[model samples]
Structure formats: structure tokens, C-alpha cells
Target: MPRLVLEARRIALTVQHGLHGRRRAGSGENFWQYRRFIDGEPANRVDWRRSARDDHLYVREREWEAAHTVWIWPDLSPSMDYASRGQAPKRERALIIAFALAELLVKGGERVGMPEMMRPSANRRIAERMAESVVLAPRLPASLPPPFAPSPLSEIVLLGDFWSPASEVAERIELLAASGAQGHLVQIVDPAEETFPFSGRIEFREPESGDRLTVGRAESWRADYDLKLVEHRARIRAAAERLGWSFTVHRTDRPASELLLALHMRMGAGGTASAAPKGGGRAFVSRGPA
Candidate 1:
């Protein structure tokens, strides 16, 4: 647990440095641009320095100085507890990413909450609050997040394996989107799950149901499994797009920093998942770690 916390903090710092590579956030005090002053506006708000250069009066619009609340959730289902050899469990990795993202958002003057675990706050202690709460929170069924209406225009970040039926996942998100909330889905999977590397005599167990299946030769099923996996991803992606939400995939074996960077950029720009910046570590690589 301690190692995971350390890793989360480290990744947050690394991503912070590269934040400039993405679209600039609007929560800063820095000046963004100047616009023409309108009638009935306060004259005191005018920027005389810039207005002197222009024929018309202008007002300096400091970057939109408003803090937004981002609600984050790391799936606590049994399936998220799976981890392949030498890899971090999906839940651990998801939480790490969530914690790190919360750190970044808080640093950017944004309020962050872990739904029922923690309340949204921009206070510097929010990250620590989130970390401690996640460690002690009781586990719930590995199902879609409980139904709740989000504040209008609020952002939601869901980190999970998302192995649930595509139709069910889509319905949950549709409900959230219906509440006028924007969202980003980060699907975290084990490399082994992405690539069926198992060979002869493999035993498979459903983490949530404890159901088991034994295959005499798993290699023969690899092709079919891969094909089905691709179709599943397409369905998931379509669901996210229908509501203008963004979706990205990550693997346990890869560095979380790259995905974190893309997420930060997308949220900062208020862009949809498809519009999120790409290119690092082959964003959305097929049959490979994302």
C-alpha cells in the first residue's frame, strides 16, 4: 500500500512537468486573452493598457477563474483485484491513477471527490483524505457505480476493468450523461487479459462469481478470444461516444504516466474522449498493452 502511494505521487509529479505539452488549463490566475468591452459592463474591469493600443475599449479576461468538481471512482469489484505475474492488481493500479489524478486536479485549483468515499474539496488535504478513505472503505459488488445524479456540468472519471456487459455499462453512463455531466472512462486491464498467452491445460475462474472453466488446450481459443475482445472494445467505445464521453485503455504492464498525461490534457481542455491527445505508448494499441 505504501509503495502504491509513493508510486502515485511520483507519477503525479512526472505528469505535472509535462502538463505544458497539453492545452493550458483555465483555472489559473494568469491572463488568458483580451476581448472587446461590452455595454453595461463595469468600466473598472477594462484593461486600459491594452485598450490604449486598440481603438475600442477592451477587457482582460483572466483565464476562467472557476474551480470545477471532478468525481473519481476506482472500481472495487472482485474483477479489479486480478493481477498477472509481476504486475500490479487492476484495482491498485486504478486507485493509483485516480489518486494521482486527484493530486493534479487539486493542484490546478479543482475540487475532487471519490463519490461516497470523500467529499469534493480543493483543500490541500483532499489527496490525503482520498488515500486514507480508499484504504478503509468497504468493498461493494463489482457492478456499475450506484445510481446518483451528478451536479450539472461536473466531470466524472471512472477507472476500472469495465468487464461488465457492454449494454449495462452503456446504460449507467447514459444515466450519468443525462444528468448533464461529462465523463472519461479509463479501462484498465491486465496484459494477460489483453493477449491470451495461455497454452495447454488452462483453468479460468470468474473472480466475481467464483465460476471456473478448464480448457485442455487454451491456445486453440486464442484467435476467437482476440476477435471477441476487439468487438467488445468497439461496443464499449461506441457507448462512450454516444454521450460524447471519452474512453481510453491502459494495461498493468505499462507505465501509467502516459495515460495520465492524456487524461489530464483531455479534462483540462474540456474535450471528449476521442479528442484527447494521443501518441505516447501507442494509445489504443491492439492486442498489446495500451
Candidate 2:
């Protein structure tokens, strides 16, 4: 757990340095700017000291200090434990991304929380807090977060392999989007899952069901497998698009920073799709049906 926290902090720091400014005007303690006082406005709102130096009365404005709530869920089901040779487990990568993202959100003055595990908070040590929660949980988290609707002011981020049935996945997404809250779906992929290199006799086991199937020549099914994967992804992507949410795919072999940066930028842009990273991956953003 300690090592995971350290790694998360490192990634968060790296992404923070590369992030651009996202300041906005709103009700906050810090002063943002001053403008000429408008007629019929409350006299007490004017900054007398500033008005004294200038010929015109001015009103001080403060930066937006209202913290937005962001709920994050990292799938820890048995399937997420699967990892290809020389690759990090899907579960580990999911947690790292979730923790790192929480840190970044907290630094931006947002409240971060896990759907059912934790409550929203702006604590600076958010990553550590989330890690501890995960370690002490009674049981492993489900592949899909429990169904719930958050306030419109809040946003959600779900990190998982999302290998669930297409209909089921779409239902969950629709349930969350019903509340009008913005959402992002990040599908973690393994290299082996994308490229089936297995040849000769091979036995494939279902992680969740413990079902096994032995194939005479696994390589014979590569083309069909790839097509199905693409079609499945398209269905999930369409579900998100229908609700104006963002969908991103990140391979476990890729740097976690790439996913973090893309996610952060998307959230900052109000769930709009940002430019994809240099490596091979897809980030889709939709504004609902035209």
C-alpha cells in the first residue's frame, strides 16, 4: 500500500507540472480582479481603498472557491487481477490511476471520493486516504460500482476493464447519467487482450466464472476476437456519447501519466474530449445527439 501511494504521488506530481492554468471567477476568498462598480449595486460591495486611488468606484471579485465533488470508482473484481506476462495487473493499474487522479483533483480545489467506500473531501492527502480505504475494505469492490445518482454539480470517473456484457455496461452508464452529472469511462486494457498471440493448444479461463475453454489453435480465432472487441467498445462508446460523457481506453503497458493527463484535461473542459496522446489509444468525447 505504501509503495502504491508513493507511485501515485509521483505520477500526480508529474502531471501537475504539465497542467495549464484553470482559474475561474466565482465566490472565493482569494481576490481575482476588480471592475468598475455598476449602478444600483450594493455600496458595501465596492472596494473603497481601490476606488480612492482611481477616479471610478471599483468592486472586487474573487476567484471561484466552490469545490466540486468528484466520485471515483476503481474496479477490483477478480477479472481485474489478470495480467499478461511482464505487465502490471489490471487491478494495480486501476488503483494507481484512481489514486493519482484523486490527488490531482484535490489540488485543483475539488472534493474527491470513492462511490461507496469514501466521502468527498478536499484533504491534501487524498491519495493516501483512498489507499487506506481500499486496504481496509471488507471485501473486494465489484466490477461495476453500485447504482447511484450524484448531484448535477458533481462528476464521476470509473476505471476498469469494463468486460461486462454490453447491455449491462450501458445500463450502468445510463443510470449514472440520469442525474445530469457528467461522467468519464476509462477502460483499462491488457496487451494480450488486444493482440491474441497464443498459438497451438491453449486453455482460456474466465476470471469471474472460473469457466475454462481449451482451444486446439488459439491463433485461428484472432480475427474474430479482434472484431468482437472493436464492436463491444463501439457499443460502450455509443452509450457514453448518448449521455455526453467521455470514454477513454488505456493499455496497462502505457504510462499512467498519459491517462491522467487526458482525464484531467477532459474534466477541466467540462467533459469535452481533448486531443489524444502520441501513443496508440482512443479518447472519445460527445456532446449528446445532434
Off by over 4 Å in 2: 21-25, 28-67, 272-290
Deviation from native of the Cα of residue 19 in model 1, angstroms: 2.0
Q: lDDT per residue, candidate 2, 115-212, as tens digits?
A: 77888887889988999888888866676788986888889999988888777889998999898889999888777766666899988887766777
lDDT of each: 0.75, 0.80
For residues 1-290, what per-residue lDDT tens digits would candidate 1 score against the true structure? 66777788899999999465322435557666778999999999899998999799998876444545789988877888877789878888888898889888877767788877777876665557788887787866445676677887589999887777777888898988787788999888787777667899987887767777888998898776766666666787898988878988788787899788888888845446563212222211222221
For candidate 1, report its TM-score.
0.79
TM-score of each: 0.79, 0.83
Q: Relative to the unseen true structure, what is the C-alpha lDDT of residue 240 in candidate 1, on a scale of 0 to 100?
A: 91
User: Which residue window of length 10 is worst by lDDT in model 1?
Assistant: 281-290
